[model samples]
Target: MSDSRQFQVALSLLPYVGAKTAKTLVSYCGSAEEVFSAPSSRLLKAPNVGQRIIKSIKENKSQALEEANKQLSIAEREDVKILIYTDKGYPKRLLRHEDSPYILYYKGNADLNAQKTVGIVGTRKATEYGKAMTQKIVRDLTRYNPLIISGLAYGIDIFSHKASLECGLDTVGVMANGLDKIYPPAHKNTAFDMIDQGGLLTEGCFGTMPDPSRFPQRNRVIAGLSDVLIVVEAAKKGGALITANIANYYNCEVFAVPGNLEAMASEGCNKLIRNHQAHIYTSVEDIEYILKWDLDERTTKPIKKSVGQLTMEEQIIMNKLEEDGGTMAIDSLSIKTQIPLGQLASQLLMMEMKGIVKALPGKQFKVVH
Candidate 1:
């Protein structure tokens, strides 16, 4: 609703600019609003700012802005939350990735940055085994209270969402289309329940149909939003495998439930594990151990220690947690501490071990006290 946000939404709707180019434009111009106002000569100075893109930006400025206003109006009327890349509520994990969407239209009460988040994906033609595995994994994950993310497609996707709901866990449906309509239409009731318990998320705008090409883009969001992506079952190729690969690329952990070597549903998971693309997932403990979520469920918060006794990195992270009201996303902490993600993750794990901090569900940390 702010003019700047309207501009950002408009900039995102540009014909030629996508996540990458939009990032470039924002980096060069300092903001989406500035990009639209910038002279063509100045825009050309940015890398990959060729004449074609620049022309599209200039030519579509008015139309895009008009459309953005209309889109925002619809979102407001429909109770959708429009999250820009720089917004506080934007998924911190996704923001850390290079190819994250410029804007997202979300309609949900669930925190996008829940302390523990997992993406459950698999083949659309799910097997009985796949469905059972999805239910079991989701039910087991209830102890950790993770937010479940999945594409709202048929087979495994729907099964995951329904299972999460039955287990009383919040589950988000990431759609290839806009929020205006649910894809596969049959999952309408499940989606309706999610809006209150978890909610639907999408990068697409109103009127955007579930085009086949857009599903890959949708898969990337599923990968980015999750701390770990689980492949309950998959084939040699499908949206689930695509999500696993993307999750790996983003430095998020990928887990595959191994199945019969010859079974069609298990082939993809088996290949991923055999080829070293993903870890072999047998039980909930594997996920708990890898993510270090194995902390005693009943462990009470430890008393705080003096800053003098802490390591430099630990003290810095602690101070940031204090500043952030005793909690912060891992990515936000990394940015505040000026620490590399890999190093930050390691330090946080060590801190968790020391009882100096507690890892929450959505990749967040809080001082134990």
Candidate 2:
């Protein structure tokens, strides 16, 4: 790591500093480097900066920087990416939440910012029914080609990851522990496969153990990373419920697969639906409807077609798409082209048949590139 960047890592090591406070310090000092360089009086001027925090900063300076340097070296040697919040590779979704991790240790080939992401979480003691549903859901969702996300725990979490792998989809396992070791130990092989097929992500750095208190915090990371979270199965209270509650707070769609009333595993899911915290997940179609994943949605190289080859409406749609930078939501296209919804749907369908356009998630369309 660069000398200047190590200071950013050092900020996380300060005794009282957390993500929000570190950001505040940076905003006050103008940069991470300045935060360290500014004297105590100057640091005091920053909002929430007081005698205690300034003292912590002053006392911990050398040790924090040294530890940060060691962290950087270990990350480099292990092929792990240490992404501070400001880095381009950091998960943008997490940025919207105040409690998002300030840094992440990622080691994988999968795109952290995949076009679509789905988080599946549930009871650690999964039932056979839960396993079946997870497998089926992943298989059906394969058409949309979304990245599957789970906690890498047993039962539904592991089922979700395994299903994703079997379907040839990338799956990221958010860890409660550090990248240095897999918690639960049994999930190690699957975690290893995910490193090649998907990824393992955590805010915990090297040598950090998976303490019990960190699991709830880890669930927040899973919720933050997902576009939507599915609770395949959960008892009345568990980490899955915690994740669901967090996802709801983020206003991301949450789906709860319905299970029989007699089943203990269904209680939490049923409660979420009953309380309107989540939609009742009946099938993949439920997901398709809310997310607007059109069956024909895709991106492809645009074929050269003459204006003469298109009907007037097709030409109009093409012109609108071009004006909109080659992509537009269905509603946007309708208003832009001044076409009625039914007519526009028909026109887009015809266009898809001719390879002039493709469907995308959320009813968006893009001209074949």
Candidate 3:
């Protein structure tokens, strides 16, 4: 590991600073190295940087760096990839979140920033219906070739991973514990298979054990990494619901597979849909439609329109769609076009009505051939 990365790892290891606080420190100091070297007065000026955290940074600077070096050595031995926030290999979508981790230990070959990604989460005590739905969704989603993400826990989590692997799709297992250990130990074989096909990702270090509190934090990473989060089955409360809420907060599309209203596993999905927190998911087509994923790329090509015949705004939007591989999130398009949201929405609606473009469920759009 480089000195900068080592420092970042060290900074993340500090007990006084979580992901959010770490982000603030880095933003204020300009770099992780600078955070450690900057004067106490300079550190205090950063938002949420209190006296206690400053003291921790000052007193444990040497110890933290030493520990970081040891962690790096362990990572090297384990063939784990240490990705700092600024690293090219880091997940781009996750990095957008305010509380995204400063250091991620990854072990896998799958692209962390795959063009299409979905997080499938649900109850650990999965029912038969839940298992069937999970498999079916993964199988159908293969057509879009999306990277599958799930917490590598029991029930729905393991089922999603297994189904993805069976469908020849890349899948990532986000763990609550360190990469050195796979929780539920029963899923060890599945985890091993993923390392070659996709990867095992975590913010936890080598010695960190699985704890109840860590799972919610892990769920946020799952929410952040995905473009959409699919709740296969969940109770009225569980980590899946936590992930769904986080995904919504991140402005990522959330989808839930509905079940019999009386079923325990279906309550979360039903509630999310009723509350307008998630879209009702019935088929893979719903996913493809919402994400603007083209079943046939040829069909998504822009309709022929002479530059002279189109409005300047229309032309600009079309260019952006083309640049973004024929699909883009509406928020991204609005920002790229520098068009106000209301005006952009009106324009997109007009385009959709004219069949010049199509709108997907998640405020995503694409040019129609």
Candidate with best lDDT: 1
TM-score of 3: 0.87
lDDT of 2 by residue, 1-369 (tens): 588789988998889987788888887898888999998888888887788899889899999999999989999999999988889999977876778887799999999999889999999999999999999999999988998999999899999999999899999999988899998899999999999999999988788899989898899989888878999999999999999999887767899999999899999999999999999998889987776665436454556666789898898999999997898778778988999999999989888878788776435678974
**RMSD to native, candidate 1:** 4.4
TM-score of every model? 0.84, 0.81, 0.87
lDDT of 3 by residue, 1-369 (tens): 689878988998887888889888988899999999999999999998899999999999999999999999999999999988888988888766678987899999999989889999999889999999999999988877989999999989999999999999999999989998989899999999999989999999998899999999999999999988999899999899999999998788999999998999899999999999999999988876666665435454445655577799999999999998888778889999999989998999888766788875346687876
Whole-model alpha-carbon lDDT for candidate 2: 0.88
Q: After superposition, how far is residue 65 of candidate 2 from its true place, in Å?
A: 0.6
RMSD of candidate 2 to true structure, Å = 6.6
List lDDT for all candidates, in order: 0.90, 0.88, 0.89
Off by over 4 Å in 1: 296-369
Global CA lDDT of candidate 1, please?
0.90
Residue 69 Cα positional deviation in candidate 1, in Å, after optimal superposition: 1.0
lDDT of 1 by residue, 47-160 (tens): 988999999999999999999999999999999999988889999889767899988999989999898899999999999999999999999999889999999899999999
Q: Total clashing residue pairs per candidate?
A: 6, 2, 0
**Runs off by more than 4 Å, candidate 2:** 295-369
- Candidate ranking under lDDT, highest first, comes to 1, 3, 2
Q: Best TM-score goes to which candidate?
A: 3
